[model samples]
Target: MLGQAVALLCLLAGDAGGLAFANAEPAWREKERLLENNKTLPCAASGTCSLGHTRQWTGDIYPLQGLRDCLRARVYRREIILVSENRLVAGFQLYDNMMQMGYDHIVLMSTEENCKRALRAWPQVSCIWSSQVFAATPKYMLDRHAFLPRAARLGVNVLCLDSDSMFLSDIYSHLKAPPLRDMALMALKDPAIGWLNSAVVYVQNARPDGPSVYVLNEVIDRLERWAEAREYMLGRNRKDFCWEQMAMSDILMSAVIGRPIAYGCWNWDRNVTYRDAWEGAHKRYFGYNETGGIGSWHFLKETKVPWPKSLAEHAPGFRRTEGVTHQQVIQIPNTQGVWPEEFGGPLYAPVRGNKSRAWMELIKSDGMPLWADPEDPAQAAANAANRELFTYLPEWIGIAYGQDGTSGYWNPALYRGANGTGTSPYALAHFYRLFGAPMNKLTVKMANNMWNWELSHLLHPRGGVFFASTEHAPIPDVLVYSPEVENREWVSHEEWDKATKALTRLAMEMGRTVVYPAPRCNLTWLGGERNNHLPLEIPMQFKHQCIPYSPSGKGFNDNRCMLGGYLMQGCMAARWYFAGGMFPPEYDHLVVHIRDKAAEHPVATVAAEQLARSWDSEELAKTLMAQHGGLGAGLFHPKIAEKLGAAAVPAVPAAAQKPRVLIIPSVLQLTDKVGPREQLYRDHEREDFNVMSCPWIQNKPFV
Candidate 1:
């Protein structure tokens, strides 16, 4: 008999995958076959079959078999079941929100047509047609009651969710506690009337005879009868619509039988239902507030609003200063010389100042006022004197005016070359004043050392390379840089040197000129080296290229006033430093100093013809020589040197044809500086790629 029962179960379990209540006919036939064979079946101790030992047990086997099949279908697990109808947009938002919280097994119960529409929108969702339950009562009253019996018969643990609710956190994980787990049904207590709110219902499929199904059927039958007498008892013109919650509350409140697992944390009503009780009793259990925490919210009145649009509307505003004068600005001290106390003592002022004091007063005390409103005559004279004095200072210590005409700040634009159109000439003149002689008297060895230093310390650390647009050009046209490499894992010194030399050679061959503009001053690769000392160990013969050209002998190197080598000639190296290596304006005024020079010289009128024609043919020849071993004897093979001069000079593209300006914008924003996203969007507006602010094209609805 046991063998026969096992054979029967194995046969029925084969079709268990298709054994829904809607398709129970095949399962019913299998149950009849088992009974006809007079096979003894497993039954619950309290069930009808156990009540009378003499009576035929055939009638009791069907429900038990149905339960077995339901269990076989693998429905008894953590699952989300939602009742939704025409609320397609709300449903989608709920589904999306659930997905964002990492809940995947979601089931939608609705009419066939509604289910079809929802499946079309989100094909990954599982749907069950439930319009038949709505035939007796209006959808809302029947919707919550309908899934319980069906889910029980299907042998699944279910979390019945309202379509309007948003799950803020993982509520399912909290339900595993012993006290909450022991209960067969769990829901939020309605604060308004002390009734159970059916917004969130957790049904545990533990009963072999399916007690939840029996209770749900009894509630539905009682409600159907109550619908007829409701109008007469209440003295109303029409039948009083019975809510499913009232039926569920009745069953839960009864003393005769089953009790529900009612906990405040599991079902928190957004309407603040039972707030005091929840706070006092279950708040510590859940560790969430009225507005926050918990697993889900019944957005009772929020059915009409879409989730994304609602979130956007309620997004917090950016904090802004009350008044312009109250706005704070940082003041940095001079690194080169003594700064006056009025301008804030030596490092930087910890406290911020208002615009008037930060902009006007600091400049007045710092020497001649560097930036002032042009409309004021005295201010203009101070600005002029500041610009004149900027030429006498180091190239790094210049400033440019802000987009607003009255303000001037630090600018990092590098003077790349005669063909380089973006750099400010005043910045270039200063660069020439410091390193003009060696740059003019170019050497292969000098260029190589400069290239090595720039590559190893700056470019390689940040995953950047100097790339020229023209073929086989020794010097790169622009520095293509990525700020993302700043936080990358530290590389060994040998690995860094190898990557630098390899990328330099590749950039030369590919005619690509680009370098990363790192924004921070503290380089992880440099370890603990002071700013005054060079990080790399240069050979004694190559130290001249590494050392700053301080003709005045006032210890420019001591203060680290000049960025050494011929890379400063075109200001390419200087621009890289300014973009990211320099400290923020609040901590360092180096950019402010650079921008002052840029404002005075302004890119447009600053010796364009002379600068454009000024290329060092001597530097170009030596660079080509160094490429094939003419400069350093042991650096290249003898055969490679023999073949060096035989190669013809690659034709330099006409200056007009060369891309004069190549802007490699920073990908990430600095904490103190204005974000680069907006500027990047504006720059790439005509390009094919999408910027951060633009709508995600793939997710957008079709026209």
Candidate 2:
């Protein structure tokens, strides 16, 4: 067979090296055991196994000296709960609750040495860390699949949970009870997205030595394929680990085996099913009004009852909250410095406010899509037809006020218990879908809950860049990209390279991390060239230059690109790319004077021009003074970093690094504190009047 034996003995436990997974199998031993049965392995026999040959991307933030200062992973029992190493305070809160429930064997992934700082700050809860922290890549996040195959081989069940998951009753009883306990692979049936949601998955490995192990191995095998495919297309891997859910859903016979039973109330304003289901139930229970009301969710085997219809089973069930501030949301000492004592819960997203909360019974089934990404018709519509009802009902858990991180709420009762209602509701709520699914800042007056503010984990806790249309003031942010060309002028995303390289170095050297914006929006590039889809990087970052925000919502490229109303959450530095975006005053600091201030020597400039024209990328690689370079003739160039000391950037001068482009990005954001927009506005109005009045243009063309 062309395929060789794979090796993922990559145990990230805090053991021999300090970042080792405690009690986990070592690399050499793991390799030996896995290979012992390699030829007969289920995945291998099926020809789907690729873990050994496929490369896993360890992302931007992955440090070399990791785990040197980390804590050891602790496993105590057969059942293990999994959570990725969260960077926020809510993560700590979730783990604390898990421990209090008297459960050990909780596994943590993406654990960096800095986690020691966070670990010491909270109660000591020993959990196994599968991998050190890495960002924007899946290797660390997908440690679930990496660990699951091992767990199945070892005969153990795994309950993977997100840090945002809320647990009220003990997690063990609810999941391991009657209907769900027996399933081989019971993924969170989110009928909303697909057949399964990996957020709250339960893998049954009781008979791991048999057919059940096949399912576990399948997930691992599929993930390897997905990773390989994504890497090939995007030239990099995405850390979202969305492929996990897709693979879980694709298990074919699994959903029939273990259908999900959804409990907690998801986003009321955002999801259509949650909205429709919630609205129907709320109205029947307490006479439909602006504010929602409470309801019961007792088992209806003919669970023909969808959502609030579950409320019908219990008559005369008027609920009450007996004046006790829910324990589940006791405010903790502020960790992110932005949180108020009033806020509490998994995320310190405020749970209490002037308006009381409400609930509705929701069912989990892979029926159809409950919600989807906003469409052009929906976004540009004059009325809120196919949109999230964010503001109409303040009772839908205190609708978000603005993007300033205020006006936030969470219902403690819904996630935990009904607190004097009929049957206890959801034991836990995975808060992956937040209050505002798409918090559109473009239309702020009617903006849905974008969770730009308040939601600590979603929005950047520390100040950073946020892109949107102007009419404000702020510190500052940066965007590096070129506008679509109008004429058949030559184009290159590589042209934008010099600016990004120089700026990235400056930012990182300043102790600022170059963090890419969240969910990077796609942009139009190499336009008018076969309408070519040229891109600097995939998941194109943040539009057109001449008509940036045209009414059609596509700018100047007809209906090619859509960009705006997005948040940037990196406390340190932001790596934003866009097509001549108008993201100036909104962010505080605008990028000015991008052109090289240092005058280049004529000899270096002449030499660079010749080098730029050279076809050999190998030669370019050798001269790649800052970031990109592969190999070849320019290798013996003089080292500039040696002579220039502190200020010098690798030894290359700007003129040498840049091509002989006609125009350079001298200024990034046009709007600034200097306030030139007012003058420009007057100039445009005057020009418009002149164009309208000039009757000469109306006459037939006179050659």
**Which candidate achieves the best TM-score against the true structure?**
2
Where does candidate 2 have its weakest 10-residue lDDT segment?
A: 323-332
lDDT of each: 0.31, 0.29
Error of 1 at 217 (Å): 3.3
By summed lDDT, which 10 consecutive residues of candidate 1 come out lowest? Answer: 401-410
Give the per-residue lDDT of model 1 (tens digit) for 19-46. Answer: 2344445655775664444323212111
For candidate 2, the per-residue lDDT at 502 reads 31
Error (Å) of candidate 2 at residue 256 is 8.1
**lDDT value for candidate 2?**
0.29
RMSD after CA superposition, every candidate: 33.2, 25.0
**CA lDDT, candidate 2, residue 694:** 15
Best by lDDT: 1
